[model samples]
Target chain A: MTNKRNQIKGFCRNVDEKKERLKKAFGYILKDKGFGNLGVNKVSLEAGISKNLIYRYFGDFKTLIEQYSEGIDYWTSQAEKRDYSEMTEKDVLKNLLGEQFNYLILNPEMRQLVLWGLHESNYNTTSLLKKRELFAERLILQKADKRFDGRIDYRGVVSVLMAAVYHLAAYSSVQKANFCGIDLSQDKGRKRVLDAINLILDNIYDLNEDKKKATNDNE
Target chain B: MTNKRNQIKGFCRNVDEKKERLKKAFGYILKDKGFGNLGVNKVSLEAGISKNLIYRYFGDFKTLIEQYSEGIDYWTSQAEKRDYSEMTEKDVLKNLLGEQFNYLILNPEMRQLVLWGLHESNYNTTSLLKKRELFAERLILQKADKRFDGRIDYRGVVSVLMAAVYHLAAYSSVQKANFCGIDLSQDKGRKRVLDAINLILDNIYDLNEDKKKATNDNE
Candidate 1:
């Protein structure tokens, strides 16, 4: 009985190791080639696992994509978890923008995946909406202030932030237009872009204050 | 001699009328199908002009798109030209946001054309770049306040505005998700979004003020 139990334990351990290896391989494949043009056979071969194993673990190609998308959300959420208490508001804003930039720039596969989500009809309803909501919620939470009154409109802020971040990301990934018609490669241009973002934030905040004051005076 | 001169004048008038008709037809076609999937032959037929005439006037499909783009830009610029002299800062911001929203929501064809410009590889580079630069310059000039002497970062402002506007445009166009999470259709949600944007803007302006003060102290 003891010998049989040891054999089963060894088999389970081996299976867990193989699962880890497969997930690592999947990341590499996704990073190297975008999800839009990824091949199941290639992913299976790269992972050094059977095609059967892929189906067994992730069901099918669509399911695999769904799983991959979930993983992306998980990873992004993890990366975005910051200690907001220690950081200034400006620092937080800068970090948020910079991190988003880095993710879109460095991860071509993920960029392509997002584009695919935007374009492909099959992936449109389930994965894209889920991801978008998750992204907005995560972002809103990260930037939320404890002092924020329930009266303060947060949807508008999310809308603006989403617009800013997604537009920049899309441009960087696909449009390749430098912000403010300035050369992105130069330090001056970079500073100008950063300054422009700061200005936009200032304008929105000022507008909010005016609204708030009006509300207060009315009350 | 009088009869011949009268005939020539009549011919010129007819030609001018035909040109006006074709231009109007072009606008209709653009509004209906968008530049991304335009059919030149169909446009020519619908315009009641010979196919060869389209080629003769616009040179090619690419030139046709460029012409349409320029026309749309001119129209938007004209529409957005406001007498800012008497407007408060909050009013100005509201006007800008409202104008953007209205423009995007109303002008579906122009919006699609802009999206195509971002995606299509065959767009004329020089013309597109020129248009973009001109648009950016106009926005900056219209919004800039020389007397403020604050570190109003125009580039950052542009970035944020463009991001917000474009993202909203894109998302609204493709929004298929039901109202489960992040319900953008709701009034309360919309208010929250506006408030969030205002808060971000306030922070940006505050930073600008600090920077201006620092610059003055240094001098």
Candidate 2:
């Protein structure tokens, strides 16, 4: 009975340690070679674990990949970490986009992943995008529609704004030269982009509110 | 005298034909294998022209690349073709941004080039970006400042809108998937983005105009 218990304890520790190792190896390959290189053999070799063991532990390599990616992807990671318990709907939306811009700028690996995701629309990337889309639908679209009450197309607003954040971060990461006279490389240039985003969002919020009030007055 | 003149004419025709062939090859490679696959040997091979002729004709490979790229790049190509002689400054600016969105959406090669341009920012892409920056400075920034004064940062507004246009077009070209609840693939979805763009641009124009009038009244 004592021997059996000790074996069980050892097995659990082994599984936990191996999972961590696999995650580190996945990240290393993802950064170095990009998403396409995350094959079973390469990852198993990098983790220095047996292929069968990895399969046995994760059930499938893709699950491990998805699990690993979710931790690093800004949407998945930040969704859990961000405290939006107190802010207004407008504030939460603004914060989400600004934080995304900051996160993509700071994380080169994440930027690379985004590039690959845009380039290739395989099962993996499509799946990743689906998660982000679902998040947007539930959080921004559904909620913003309720608050703004259809003053404007809220989805379109977020789409353009979110896309701008993604593109600027990706472009600025490499070039940092300029986009329409705005030098994204410089601190001043980046601030201008962020400020403009804030300004636009504020304008939108005001527009929604004013339109809302006008309708109320009319009634 | 007749023989010598005919020989000179024949040589000139040969050079023009070779230039066309080289341009075709460059486009072929740029679309097929991407920018990295563009090398002298491959272009020569595809064009069925001697490597020495390519060098002798263009003076250098980079010049050929730039020359070829300029014709396809939206800013360089459209600068010559677009009829903005009669439009107001506001109309022209709005049209430029909106046209870029339509152009990028329609041109897949342009989208691919954009992806590479963002990924790599060597002399080629930077120079390309420089041309765009110069155009913006000369055309938009200069005139916009004269018109709007210190009303708003026109550059920032343009940056977000332009980047969003690029991102959505590129993302839509490949994935055709929903981004933040906006599906860029469908016509209705695309119309939403374009409509939102016009609305945002109109708001900025009105804001700038309103601020300008307010300042003028005070003076």
**Number of the top TM-score candidate:** 2
Model 1 over residues B38-141: C-alpha lDDT tens digits?
A: 57777778788887877776677667657666666523454346665587564555556556654665566656555544443345533664566565456443
For candidate 2, what is the DockQ-based docking class?
Answer: medium
DockQ per candidate: 0.28, 0.63
DockQ of 2: 0.63
Which 10 consecutive residues of model 1 chain A have the lowest summed lDDT? A139-148
Clash pairs, model 2 backbone: none
Q: What is the lDDT of residue B185 in candidate 1?
A: 38
Instruction: Identify the candidate with maximal lDDT.
Output: 2
Error of 1 at A55 (Å): 12
Across residues A1-219, which tens digit of lDDT does each residue of candidate 2 receive?
999999999999989999989988988987776554568899899999989988888898877877887888898888756677798777888888888998998886677668767666776677788888887677667888888777798778778888899889878888956788777887788889888888888888778888999999999
For every model in order, the TM-score on chain A comes to: 0.69, 0.89
Q: Give the per-residue lDDT of model 1 (tens digit) for A1-219.
A: 999999999988987776666666666876664443467788778888898877776667666666565556423444445565577554555566666655665555555455444333365234656665665455444354332344454445545754565555545544444555655535465556555655554454555577678888999
